[model samples]
Structures are given as C-alpha cells and as structure tokens.
Target: MKKLIKYGNENSQYGELYLHDTNCIGTVCLFHGGFWTMPHDLHQFDNVAHELLNLGFCVWNIEYRRIGETNHKWRDVFDDATKAINELNNIKNIYNHVNINNVFVVGHSAGGHLAIWLNSQDLKIDVKKFIGLSPILDLEIAYYKNAGDGSVEKLLHGNPNEFPERYLFGSPIKLKRKNSSELIIHGNMDDYVPIKWSKLYHEKIRKFTDISHLIELEACGHMDFIDSKSNVFDVLKSNIR
Candidate 1:
C-alpha cells in the first residue's frame, strides 16, 4: 500500500501529489502517460514505483491534470511538474533517507515526453537527470502522421498551425538548448514515437551539451522500459548509476 497526501487543489484537476517513499537514496518523481496526458490511469505507476522502492530509491510519483485532465495545457503541465519537484525538495525531511542530490524525473510515453520537455526548460531549479522512455518528443511528426486522426494535435489543443511555437517548445528534436538536463534511456523498437525524436534531440543538443544520452532498445516496445521484469530494466539500471 502507498501513503497518500494531497497538495495543491484537492478539487481541481491540478496540484495533487501522490507521494511514495521507497526509503532509498535516490528520489524519483514519475509522471503518467497518455499523450503528455493526465487524469491518467494509475496502473502503470505501480510496478516502477515498487521496483524503485525495493531498489532503495525514495520515489515521489506525481499525479497532475493532463489534456483531458481539467483545463490544462502542455506548458501548464510542464510548470506543474516543476512546482511539484520543488515542493518535494522543500520538504525532503518528510520523505526519509532520500538523497537530495540524486533526484531524478522519469516518464513513459506522453509522460516521458513531459519529463524531457520539463527538463529541457530554462528553469531555475534543475532536475538532475531525465529518463524519457519512448516519449513522443516530436509533436510535429505525430501531427503529420495524423495517426489516431491527429490525436497528438488535439492534445495540444488542435492544429499545429494554431500553435506553431508551442510545437517547437514541446519538440526536443526542434529546440536547441545550449545546455540540457541529463537525459538517458532507450525507446522501444516497436513503439510509434520513433527513436528519431530522441535521436535528433541528442544529436543537436550533444553539440552544445554532453548531459543527454538516448539508447535505442531492441525487442522492446513503448511501456516496456519501465517494467522491471523487462530487458530494458537491465539497460536502464546499467546507466542510472
């Protein structure tokens, strides 16, 4: 069982913190998936939270409002993640035995996209490392595919033409930050997000910053990166240290 604590708006689709302490050295904050989404299903959070706990990492898995999650935007979700991490950092004593410096942020699918988006932001409080497991980092690609009839476009509030700059910001492949927050992980070979997003993001950012690294995985698909029993766990574990 996980201890639940509510922060931010209890009634609003925003500002609720699902705090889980694994009593470990690293403190990881995980966001859920569904196209940079929220009001998300909590099922995927369990295994990774539990695995990180058993591995001795204090995990503060977060829950925030997503696209269909109340009145939120991609930028707002990014801010929400930032504030949540700062909130946790402020009250680290409550988390217990958690290393403050080893703090990390991770996401799967859309959540993975959010993790990278937030990490790539020009914020004052920097996340130590980011693990975007098969994140939809390139909104433009999804928009072009019109897959799910432009489901990715709809999440960004419709039509990349309506929000050209927003697409640029959300896209790790497009934006070139002089320095990036640490990113390391692999995308599932079968996943639709494609390795190109992570790949291009690495290629461009690596020119200016050495903090980012992306690994492409074989025989793995999308959510498999977070599953402890999956082969990705070995790859993720290998580099996390």
Candidate 2:
C-alpha cells in the first residue's frame, strides 16, 4: 500500500511512499517530468510507484513546486528534490524495515534531468544509482533548441547567454560527478528531448568515470519509458537493482 506523506510545507511538494507488507529491498525515488512546469505533477507516477512496489522496492514518488506556480522559482524545484531525499532518509525511524543504503532514483523526461542534477548535489544520503529515462541533460542545448516551447528559458528565467551561471548550475551535463553510477535510457524515436542528449552526456561522463551508461530502446518514444506495458518497462525493472 502507498502512504501519502508531506516533505515540504506546500501541498504540491509532497511524496507518496509505497510500502510492502514485508521483504522490502530498498527505496526508489521517483520524479515525474513535464518540462518542469505545472501542467504535470506526481499523479503521473502512480503506476510507476505500484510497479516499483511489486518489484520489492519502496517507492518515494515526489511532487515539487513548478515554474507555473505562484512565486515558484527554478531553484525551488531543485531544493524540493533535495528536501524530499533528506526526508526519506529520516523515515527509517518510522519505517525501519526498508534498507536505506540501497536507495536508487528513477526519473523520466524533465524529471530525469532533476534526478541527474540531484545526484550531483552533496546530499546527506548517497544515492546508490541514478536512472534517467530520456533526461534533458544539457540545458544549454535545450535552450538553443527551444525544447518544450522554451521550457528551458522558463525554468532558468533567461536564455543561456543571459544567464550562463544558472544554466551551468542546472545542467546535468555540466554537473556530472565522478563518483556517481548513472544509467541513461532513451528511446530511439523520441522526438522530445531526443536520444542524442543522453548519448552526449554518456560520452562526456565516461571520460572521467566508467560508471555511466546510455541505453537506446528500439521502437520507443518519449512516454514509453513510463508506460508499464512497454518493453522499456522490462529494462527499468532489471535496472532497479
């Protein structure tokens, strides 16, 4: 069963923890992607949470403030993610059956970008592995390409040339860490956030550490990564370990 929990003051910034009756392996921190805007929220990850629970994982599906919301900033989204992770780590006292050391992260689309960026941050809890499903790893490229109808600019508050430091701080490509074990999965036919981003990210990270890998799924699209019935589901199931 899944239990609703609040990680932050706002109702939008909360998490759903999927707990098993027994034999829980670890936790999977889920972040949903909708170009970092308000149109999409954590509800999209309900199926993902259930699936992860069935796979013996305690899923912490999180929701955060988006750009469309009142007075919400791009940095707040990142801060919300950090707070969620820290809150989950503290939950061991309440839910002692779950393993904390095996905590992993699975983020799709824009959520994937957040997952990668969050992994780069110096958090109290160390993520065991980060799985990004079609992440927008390069903010600079996303800004130039104008992905999601200028979603990059909307999130960063300006274009790359206008806010180079913001782009530098938010881009996962620029924030790649040497100690992280990152697996990026992209669909070959993804029109949004194209597979090339993951390819370039893997290429860049592999130079510093051999722990990063990029997998391209045949006949998959942008949403296939989150579809429980898709073949990519098998890939996600296997990689959660």
Choose the strongest candidate by TM-score: 2
Candidate 2 local lDDT, 1-241, one digit each (tens): 7788888788687888888877588899999999998889998888878888888888899898887898877688888988988887677778887677898988999899988888788888878898899999999999899899998999978887888999999988897584868899999999998898889889898888888888889999999877887789899888878
**In candidate 2, what residue range of length 10 has the lowest lDDT sum?**
172-181
Q: Can you write out model 1's per-residue Cα lDDT over 77-170, one digit (the tens) per residue?
A: 6666666667665546566545667777787777777777776565544557777877767788878976435667767776678899888877
Compute the lDDT of residue 46 as modeled in candidate 1: 75
Prediction 1 global C-alpha lDDT: 0.66
- In angstroms, the error of model 2 at 207 is 1.4
Q: Give the TM-score of candidate 2.
A: 0.96
**Please, what is the whole-model Cα lDDT of each candidate in the order they appear?**
0.66, 0.86
With a 3 Å backbone cut-off (N, CA, C), the pairs that clash in candidate 1 are 24-56, 38-66
